[model samples]
Target: MVVHSKFQSDTVLSYSGSIPYTCYEIGHTWEPGCVKTFFQTFCDAFKFSIRVYTVFYLATFVIKLRKKENRRIKKIKKLLRDILQSSIFLSANGAFFMGGFCMLRNLIGKFYGWHGLLAGFITGILSIQLERKSRRGMLALYLMNLAAETLFNMAVARNLIKPIPYGEVIIFSIASAGFMSLFRQRNGLPENLHSPLTLIVGPEESRDFYRNGGNFSQRWRLISCLPYLQKLLQRLKTVHRSHQSCPHNNSCTYYTLEGIFKQFLLGYGIQILLNALQSLRGKQKWSKVFNNISLASFLAGFIGLFRACNCSLRWLLDRDIPALHGALSGAVAGTTLYFYRSTSIALYFFFKLMEVLYFRGIREGYVPHLPSADQYLYASTLAIILHASCCEPHNIRPGYWKFLCGVSGWKFPVMFRKLFDVFGTKATTLYPNFVPDLDPRYVKTTAVMELLKVHGKWRDPTNF
Candidate 1:
């Protein structure tokens, strides 16, 4: 069952003008660079949203307040710089390795197989290299990644989670932060480099554990007043422990039945409400901003779905599915959704609405009709439910993609306009509302953090 290269096959099949069919060319759809480029674009887009709406606004409010008479302006300024730098790095590279390896698998289909066994191995190794900025931090990232790889291998090798639905891994991932590297850092700093880090956000007790000296901020002081934070975390801990059951072998990890059930109910309920909202509101500035968040989340979710489809296809065909499936899936999904053609478009809109409402949008200055500050609690509840509902085996229909319009929407025209322009379109022109007028301090501090990792100055805070 050898796959004949086009060179060997005299018949060349090439069609254009939006014919619905399958693609076989290796680099045509799944080229590694193509995969990376789309995700990079996605990350940058979302990064703007995070900065302009959330970090920038909050930082300005904190810096401008005349009420804090005791605090010096210089200190406020420094804190602002630090917070923005850390957030940018996290948003930019938060999903870097997952997205990177997915890209690489597509690009190097010759080397990697359907199970992504090679991709996982390569991902495990490369994560240590590209992401390594500090020795200790690198080590920690390596260990956490190793744990992830081991779990993936177990799932493949023993079929430990077989017929368990492909998205179960994602559920486990979100619940445990399995794809993320975690350790004790001064902030959510990159373990491998010094230039960028997310400011570690937690309950006041957790903050107390990380902070030096007795000094604290007024805002944080208010956070400490909430007595329920620790109680909630303790409950989470108990649930986490229950999910940690070892099934004789330590090869794979998955969501707890409780976590899965809880998340599905809540997330689905939120999604329903969001979908209802989409029916009512036309695109406005705030709505557009929220829509972008929805769009990005939709893209991410589609990627997850495509990955599952490819894995399942590999299993069914008894042949290694090409990485191009990953690339092709992304391109197809994006092109399809952007053009408003595919049936999945409906799913995309619904899920995207859910994503913005529950996970990211509200954090970035979106306020609901409700005035309660306990929005996060509700969002969290929604996230859990939607995650579970989306994971249901019945929700997926991978092969059926017939109902699609070949073209619609302005995206294609806009792309063509850029392609033909002698003078390039301004980079910031597309997302005018979200562009950040960033300071040099944020860049400098983030660069320093990454430099430390690349230069070998970083040590894992957890190790100490």
Candidate 2:
């Protein structure tokens, strides 16, 4: 009777198991439920975050080591501090932008993958408030972010790895890299424009010293005997001074225009040379190359004209609303790049103007002062989060990316340097004959340095 009961129970159990069980064991089951999926995703995200942070920390450490030779303790402390700051900034930016992008994608329906472009544009604009960097520098950083993201996307498309949250990766990379770059010391002077005079004498003194200098020769020698070039420069200077004395001489229309013309000519010549090389490489017709050269030259000239006009307008309205002046100048510059639909240029300048005003307010104590570190952390976190959570990515056409890529090759750097000069950063000395790697410190003769010392002493009688 007991054996008969056991057989019956086993038969009943087998009968139940033959059908799929509601919550547990069944004939077959494969789906991971919501909770399990969520946990898995969370684990993946955490791993990704750690890997990214490690890479960033290592890169930053290497850069800092190369830049400074501090003692071991101090170096380690600095590295730790920077890492902490970078991690915080990146985490905040990533969390915020990711939410924002997801929301935008839902609302705008993807926009043909142009959402990335919009995110990048916003990133560039917002970066200005956090770091005192040139617009070109900010743009370059953003492009780097985009390129990295694109490469990752390509890898995913090729099934190199399982699908992962790339948006998070991009935002983190950009924030970390941008923050890291804030600490990088600018070369301050371009290699092409390096000169003994520039190294010894400051920018203002060098400009004054070279005011009567002649045009650059074929060999880039600063020859003073070029009668026609000297006459033309004198006339331009005269016209520039005809207007009210600009508060900032660097912004003077005449000087700005002259600088623009010089830079344009140099850039145009270089473009022609590069085109020749390209033609040889591709075995293209000379006529086609010549046509391209003409087009490039025309574009270069247009950009130079627009920049000169912007500088002039800023100088003319120096006394009035400075912010408005900046906006107008930016608008004018943007108009010139209208062919490329570069409205971002205007937006960039507007933000730059606002940033300047904010700084001024802080200095004058009109604005409440916050601790620098706290301010950076808080602002960066807030801006990125806000952007990510609330905003949708505005799609930019793919053609625009191609156009930008074409323009960004070699000429972009030269163009950016000219813009830097316009802002009076003196990033490149105007000296035509300077060679790279000629350090002033190694020279045995202290004649020039001694003269400068005496001149400085003369200017400041208190020192005597």
Candidate 3:
């Protein structure tokens, strides 16, 4: 009797037989079973948390090392510390909220769609309340969450991406937004901040500094040129004032509007240049360039109008409720752009009203007690463990991933430099003839020589 194997290496075997025998390849890998999957998920979650903690810790450490004697440095340090604290709290709160949302969704089987929306709304409110102590921050978080959910649903409807489980997505978005808002809250600086130029040079000297072609740094190059720009503005203002007799109070408004318009025009010009360059790179036709220019001009004009309106509102109210003003201006912009649908518009309005009510509540001594730092940490650990056990891995992309990637890319060069320093020294000493190219004096001296020259020149008072 002859027997045939039903399986072959790297191929399926076919045979007609009453009895079947299967043979397996020696080197093929099998799919992960339940145990392996659980271990892998746990490891991934732990690594992610560690990465988050390490990145923030290192960043804060770097900022702390800067000279803190200067007031600006002190303020920057405080801002960094506050940011680190807020981020840790927000991440912890978000994880807890997500775990609860997933649990609720799993428990409730019928009307999955309604269950998801309700869960998302509740999670959003709770997440915002826990993540931020300020009423303004909370309101902003709520409105942004609504807007994001609306956009995501629209994208799904249009088949831009696969349908997401809204509950899971909402939880992920809240966490992602919390991190983003923490960074963006103060324009990547401390809150209620003055310009660094104003801080560095007193008001009297700042004019001269600007007049001298401000060379503070690459970031503040624009500020250095501001004095020259302002002089031209003043000249134009004088021309307008001489042409028309205007009261001082009315003149201030006119000047403010004029500044807004000037800024808009300047930005429009820059946009056109950038669009032209992009068009050249992409080999776009003239029609596309015209469309780009037109769109850019429209956006620039809208931004200018929004700023003018915001300034007017602040001037009239004589109070600084930037959150309220921002929402109102954003609504106008949204309406002008035809960006939001009826549902989203209504939701926005509802959030605006809620923001007012919430502000009032806080004013009336209704501030909610927030969780302590220790509690936040404990909750985060528990939430992470629960999520690892019960939920599939979340694949939501963060808005700042590109920024983080750019930051992390620097590590490779730094590591390579350090390795070369250590190995080059040892290799040159031990095997000079065999590894002559590894000598640190030859390979790494160029940068050091350049720095030495700069230092020597700067040390001579004549250079300064």
Candidate 4:
């Protein structure tokens, strides 16, 4: 009869009850050691890259198809070319980083949690070189956002830092304010810098920024209050109803309600679609449509509150300072983040704001232009993510973790944690959730690595 205990790899104390040899590291029995792991990872990355690129590029192609300006055949060709480029960059990036980890381990005969950082850094610098230069900056910015959040979460987990109250709200507020100012002059900027506010507030209305009605007549302030009231009422009733300083061509009440309804529907539709996706994944009941209603409410409330605040400010000052209006209204609208409390969205926008500002500085000659900065930042951020994911999985963002798992062929869980335990990362605590790649109960025979749903027989992990 076969004897079993928890798949402990740290010690070799038993024969039948001993930890499997493959458990000593990540590679499965059929693919023992570092060299085999590299080849295995290469295959996984290649297959996953095609699937990921198809999904992304297919959606883009469908969107571009709506615009008749581009020839259909040309668009299809572009799509195929982009997908090819993407696959090469992504496959190489994923394969090298993952295989790099094992490669690094082999050099020293053992690996620690921090070794993932070195592997990631080397792989990132090398892999990014294969990517299109035009795409590097955006990729760097996106990775920077994830890295910042990961770093902060890790710090909090270690009690090295405390969570800030309403921090995301504050960050979103500042970034949104800056974005609004930029959006006002978007005509001079990249075509892709569109904001949802343009759709909700009306393009014409948003474009009329910095409009200032001259101060009210002193005579009206002293007397003829009735005429002044009449003038105000007349302005509200007119087709282009708005304070002289206001931009919209509608009564404040109409504009406010219109924005509210449209924005609400926009947000609601998005949330519903997300819920539908979740339902497909069997994560939640589809009937519970209102379960995450606040996510929609956050967007709807933001539009309403922002317009109300901007109108009030204009009415109070009897004029409009476009800068003040944008800043204050954005700040007020930012409070809506409290409805959903999404740390991820806020953190992303914070990095995005910094990126935009830095770019602006470069254009204005205030910031130095650094070539390859994007790749460097990308490498640095990837290292942080690699180190954190390996050493402190608990701190990684759930979506990011899931994405990493998919890209890595679910190998994150199968990583041999016994060596990492030396770093005092509390890795053993996470060990129970993941089976070692070489567990006797579930030996892998083929190159395709999948975690089977059924647990054949798990021996209660015994302490060595």
Candidate 2 clash pair list: 96-385, 97-388, 100-388, 100-389
Give the lowest summed-lDDT range of ten residues in model 4.
14-23
Distance from true location, Cα of 373 in model 4, Å: 1.2
Model 3 C-alpha lDDT per residue in residues 1-464, reported as the tens digit of each score: 11112211223211111111100000001111223422333343334444564576567667756766533666666655655545544443333333333345335521121222344344444444444355335435443544444455435644687854333423323332222222222332232222532332112111112223332133334543889865664455455331121112223344444434544455467666766887888866645553444433434443444445555555677643444554454444333232212333334434444444454455667965343422333333333322211111111123322222222221111111111112111212211222111212222233322332433421332433
Which stretches of candidate 2 lie above 4 Å from their native place?
A: 1-39, 46-244, 247-254, 261-330, 337-464
Question: In candidate 4, which residue ranges exceed 4 Å CA deviation?
Answer: 1-30, 69-71, 106-113, 185-189, 195-197, 204-241, 290-292, 433-464
Q: Write the per-residue lDDT of candidate 1 for residues 390-463, one digit (tens) a residue.
A: 11111213221010000101111112111111111121233222212222222223322343344354445445
Report every candidate's CA lDDT. 0.31, 0.36, 0.35, 0.67
| TM-score between candidate 4 and the true structure | 0.79
The total of clashing pairs for model 3 equals 1
Candidate 3 residue pairs in backbone clash = 214-224
Worst 10 residues of 3 by lDDT: 20-29
TM-scores for all predictions: 0.23, 0.33, 0.35, 0.79
Per TM-score, the best of the predicted structures is 4
Error of 1 at 452 (Å): 46
lDDT of 2 at 49: 43
Give the residue spans of candidate 3 off by over 4 A: 1-39, 49-232, 239-254, 261-303, 306-357, 365-464
Pick the winner on TM-score between candidates 1 and 4. Answer: 4
Taking all chains together, the TM-score of candidate 2 against the true structure is 0.33
